[model samples]
Target: MDGFDETFDWVVVGSGAGSMTSALVMRQAGKSVLVLEKTGYVGGTTAKSGGVIWVPNNPLMRQAGEQDSTEAGIAYLEALAENLPGSTPEKRRAYVVESQKMIDFLLAQGIPLARGADFWPDYYDEVPGGCKTSRTVTARYFNKAELGPEWAARLRPGFVSQPAMLSEGLKLAWVGRSWKIKLLLLRIGLRVIAGKLTGKQWVSAGAALQGRLLKAVLDAGADVRIDSPVRELVIADGRVAGVIAESGGERRRIGARLGVLINAGGFAQNQAMRDRFMPGTRAEWSNTPEGDTGDMHAEMERIGAALGQMDQMVGYQMTRMPGWEQAFVKPPAQSLTGKPGAILVDQSGQRYMNEGGSYELYCQTMFERNRTVPAIPSWAIFDARFAQSYPIAGVRMAKMHQVWKDSGYLKEADTIEGLAAQIGVPAEALQATIARWNGFVDAGHDADFGRGARAYDQWLGDPFLKPNPALARIDQAPFYAVDVVPGDVSTYGGAVTDARARVLRPDGSVIDGLYACGVSSASVMGGVYVGAGASIGPSLAFGYVAARHAAGLDNSL
Candidate 1:
């Protein structure tokens, strides 16, 4: 403390969902809090994401008349985390118990949160103790103008920036088919017009959630700074005491009397770290913001924090498009390939894994398939019927950009064989694969991989399709193809923390006064994603745990 330029009761690094939650917790405890963000924006990758928080037994669910219990939630997590390296029994129980408390705290502080769609089933709804009715939560739409100009401009944008809620936005894909969806679009359009007239900038999804959290943190009088990156963690008396960081082109040593919490995200933007930990993936394919470069990861490792699950990522399949490097949201192919009348095949025109399932498992399968075959860039083959009925990469098939074909991102042909030839796959093999898929459609069941067998898989499929929503004949003419890569939402790896969110050493001893959450720590859900917002829910929960621990408060409301 003698050499420190400034001091605070708690110092939090990286302004993602967890960072904001921890800051609010400390502030509520009457402790001085400082939140440092590496990027100019206050929200990290959370801002660009869907911002769904998968909290089991949350108040929103209870209020909605959905039945859930802490024991049931723990059972589901145990099933998912069984034999996984990054999770422990204590951590799993703590996540289920503390998640509701965290949400309650947010509500008490007046954060606008509500339950997501009841139809949005858990990714593994068929698993024991899984809530098929859904346990996801999201923030209500927020007007950025509420944050004032400076803060509003600094809030990172989400993929879906419209004023509509996420539940309404999901129906957008079926707008062409449903009159209900068309009317919903009209409502959203009117909402946007109203915002424009009132000089209000409304944002939805992740941006909306982060905006509400940021507003609360600012209102609580927490000192928040951007463009301030922590370079090193300073240790005193064999514990973390402060951080050496840079701000306004000046280096400063800031001490945390209680502790320093790192929620700075993972190395999804760091190619070197990806090559070292996850070898089969490319950093460019990740949708995480550039600030996810793992600077704090290296710093934490230098301080003897044990890193685990470096090989895992929140896999989100995508197809590259024109200007993809600068695109706000990468062209998602997760739902596209799983929709009716579409199927994914390897380079040899062979169908491997089930085309419909969790996107995390989908990309994991891509890497796994690549180990034995050329599946890194698989082919998503679809027919004209699908083209006319659905959208690809946010553009309807009839209105696909010319640059898509010019850039070799899209391939079209009058026949299945012709499309296969164009994509450099064996025509005969492609034809046989399509024939087999069509047979499955006729029989109303997938014998090979059980495509629509699960509730989650059907949710990813076309809801309008009959029999099996995930299965359809791919026999129509004018077939098309696009290259699908194992893109990622964020890398799922980092310093291992205990149940209390304390960074731990390799020997299972805690790094005194040091905490980590979000992507900065190994995922609490292990390698499997149980539902949407699994990452965000644990992040906020652990962040709350970290702050309460730092403030010498117990885990109670």
Candidate 2:
């Protein structure tokens, strides 16, 4: 052993939104805190994700003149998660109440958030209590130049490159006459080029957010140990006493007199765990640095922590580069929501669910369909015209055509039947499905699945198209299909915790001095995702709750 010993009042493991929030909360409460990260860099998957945090009825929403109530938000989630496990009344209440507290705390800490004014749309928008609001908040794009040399290098390069503001990659295919987004993109592009020309590095959204959080923690005199993986939780007399960590190939014991907060992410990268928990899932995750091995869950389980909602995991159907292991292809919003895009079909070439649904629902539907049929190698078919008009993810349609073909994704066919045949689907069934879809397009209404029928779905669809930009017939020729596999942003299930953000035993008592949040804890959303920022909202809230409760802040509840 190299002989390194450190102690703090609170120790937070994992540097995602949850861990940062917890650490910051504890710091604000006048507690000395230390954050231990396994990876060389801080910021977990959150630094790689869309930084928008969804908080219904938040100050930002109210300032934008959007009316939302806690009851309405709960109603919306309840309707979507209807029969799902973990959707308890207490959990729902805690999510809403704590969410506001998180927003207030962040704002007080100089974290500026712009309202995602037009981004509201629950997966099931037609359900009761679902409405459009600027509830989601995003940070202003900060240039990596502002973070200084030492701190910038400490960040994971790829992780900070996403939630690619209109600057990095446009989320909406077209700006729809929004000069703000256009200007932002232009500014970002110029800055990136300038930085490249000068041999300087650049970072955005998730990275920027992480940098801000880290700066706040450091400013508050908190210490962080990189490449230190917490191996075991030290429990004594039914309370977490400290942690055993491996740093620099040597074991070091760090005692946390107050608590140990575990935010070490979920098991998305763990194939064995994925296979065991989410059977039949192609558990490819585009997450933070790949070292996230679900250590928090494993440690908690060893200590007899009760696990909740192990069956749930966040899912995204990803478009990947054919031969590259690290490179990924982001699918265009138009490809999923626009009229030209065909319904996603499984390996057996059968229709699964509404292709215009949110990514979470899309994954859920794909998983369910895979159980009944071979949905692993599913395809997103579209016409040449749609490809030509809209940007598909980070790549243009023409570029995507080449990349998909080269990557063994795009399957060209002169007709739908030919395409179906190539994909190993019953040609007749695919033809019939297309015919029905065309009928809906012509009638300006989707009767079966109601694609583009709701305000939220429309938010993701083309706004210029009448009736619904998301609705269109697939009668055009030169049909094309690209394979899509179920991918994930991160895993959702981890150590189970209560409303107070306290880790719970199987018998439902708090594991004193221990707290878990973020992807390291069971999602408060249950199995249904609400919108873009749902993951981060609960993460921040629960982290705050955990820190507050741990610091003995009137833990009456």
Top lDDT prediction, candidate number: 1
Task: State residue 96's C-alpha deviation in candidate 1, in Å.
Answer: 0.8
lDDT of 1 by residue, 199-276 (tens): 888898999999999999999999999999999999999999999889999999999999999999999999999989
Full-model lDDT for every candidate: 0.90, 0.72
* Candidate 1 wrong stretches, greater than 4 Å: 555-557
Q: Output the lDDT of residue 387, model 1.
A: 89
Error of 2 at 255 (Å): 1.0
Residue-wise lDDT of candidate 2 within 336-438, one digit each (tens)? 5334455666776666677777777787787777777888767777777766666554457675577677666668788988888777788888888778777
* Total backbone collisions, model 1: 0
- Model 2 Cα displacement at 378 (Å)? 1.7
Q: Which prediction has the highest TM-score against the true structure?
A: 1
Evaluate model 2: give its TM-score.
0.91
The alpha-carbon deviation from the true structure for residue 428 of candidate 1, after best TM-score superposition, in angstroms, is: 2.1
